[model samples]
Target chain A: MVTVNGEQKNAAGQNLLAFLKTEGYEPERVVVERNLDIVPRDELEKVVLEDEDVVEVLRFVGGG
Target chain B: MEQERKLSKDADPEKDVQEGKSLPDQLQIEDPEEVKKQMQQILSKEELDRAFDARFPKEMQQKFRGARVAIAGLGGLGSNIAVMLARSGIGHLLLVDFDTVDVTNLNRQMYLVPHVGMPKTRAILQILYQVNPYLDYETVQAKVTPENVKELFGGYPIVCEAFDKPDQKAMLVRELLGQCPESTVVSGNGMAGVGDSNGIRTAKFGNRLYVCGDRTTDVGGGVGLTAPRVALCAAHEANKVLQLILQEDS
Candidate 1:
């Protein structure tokens, strides 16, 4: 099981970016943090997700 | 004869002659009136009052007497933010920047010509103290990373993210939210171009993170920033931080 934005789901064995895309999120609009370290925007395709990994995705919205 | 004798008796001629001789050729009594006149000629009380009121407010005049704020960068955004915070009475400031003050910084950064070769943190701290003698400041002459982020933050509640690089700014935001959830972080974006004054906006992401500046819409190819826009973004960030501190729903 992996937690993405507080919801738990089964590990799909896909890369982090693909997982997020399949989950209806846009890559350019958000920042992703896996565990504690920030996964840079360019490295989203290379970073693999594992079981029980907690991922936080933050999106840029209208803000000052 | 009677008038002459009366004048001689009352005058004390010998004593007056002796006193006159004892006095120096040029009497130089230190006259406070002369010094006061010189001072008035130099500066008026209204000017002094304006200078005092410009930096120190009645409520925050001494509020941050022992507080410490660590600024992570000293570029266009960092330099302006640091100086404004120091002037607003943040007591102790810890400035962190590995870059040196460059000529380009002069266009937007408030640092002067003499700070060219000096480290950004040191140069900005010196200028900050010059603006307000009441400020106490320190410097970290390196970049902020995950290794030193905790140590750098040092329990400070507010952090202004002024880094130009997107990755560095995102990294700091990630570190703060994950490691120090209680800390409030303010960030700026799309402030590098020309736009109307109304372009600047402040928005709250959640309870903790607030971002200020023009959104990416204003980041068209040729938009260049001036001091007014940068200062406006920083002011919005600082105002949001103040709101967070006061527990206001911003």
Candidate 2:
């Protein structure tokens, strides 16, 4: 199970970038954190998620 | 003496800047009467120091006194951020803006009716000085771009992004994160359109970027930005600045 934004999802062996696309998050707008460490934008594809990893996905919104 | 009293009473800051001269430029004239009048309008240095100490909390006063923060814009987010920081006793600020106050900005930006023609940087500083006379701040009337981003925000430990455009926000964050990795940046997104104020939140992204707002809302389909919501996000940014300042390691 992988926790994304506080909700658990079954993503035991998915690539971080693939998981983001599968979950409908825009790759450019979203920032990904794996297990409390930030995954830099360029390194998203190289990183893969394992079981019990907590992830947080955030994006920039359009106001001041 | 009577002439001095009349000149002091009749001195109007707005009228003094009639020739497109800035506030500081008007003060540079060597006229003794004008100098005396300007002196009477502002508090003495000793009074300003006393007011700063009395207006802020005694325990956290020193922390605020020593912290230097930069606000990257002077629109809705930047203006309110400056005001809140000033009232909270944050001692130093660096404000940057290339725009002047417009009538349209009155809805959300912190400008009064008479400030329509004034540069946003100058107008906001006027209001801030009234709130806390002892604040140490500098205003740069220029745009922040990738080339000048680091130069504008380089020294401050914390920089607040208040640009109205999404691309500008992204540019500043990217530049700061790369150039000044040790600096913390507080930015806003998705605070447009009236919804639950509770939806606005502060989240830490990467090591030094903290974003405030719901991260979803934008202005379109007749939905507009309002003051209450924008100010809430500004409060979050200001609070984060204060928190970082009070940090022992900061």
- Please name the candidate that would achieve the greatest DockQ relative to the true structure: 2
**Interface C-alpha RMSD per candidate, 1 decimal:** 5.6, 2.9
Residue B90 lDDT, candidate 1, scale 0-100: 66
Q: What is the CAPRI rating of model 1's predicted complex?
A: incorrect
Instruction: Provide the lDDT at B55 for model 1.
Output: 62
Per-residue CA lDDT of model 1 for B1-250, tens digit only, reads 4564446456766666643223234423233244334444545546655776786665444344444556677787788878777656666777778899888778777778877877887677556644554446677898788678888874877777777665566677767765665577787765665566688788765556777876563333555557777778877776665555445322
Give a tens-digit lDDT track for model 2, residues B57-144.
6768888878899999998899999999988778789999999999989999999886788898878877776676666768899988
Question: What residue pairs clash in candidate 1, if any at all?
Answer: A64-B201, A64-B202, A64-B203, A64-B211, A64-B212, B193-B223, B193-B224, B194-B224
The regions of model 1 sitting more than 4 angstroms off are: A1-15, A19-30, A33-64, B1-62, B217-222, B248-250
Interface DockQ of candidate 2: 0.48
Q: What value does the lDDT take at residue B168 in candidate 1?
A: 69
Residue B248 displacement in candidate 2 (angstroms):
4.0
Candidate with maximal lDDT: 2
Superposed on all Cα atoms, the candidates' RMSDs to the truth, in angstroms, are: 16.2, 8.2
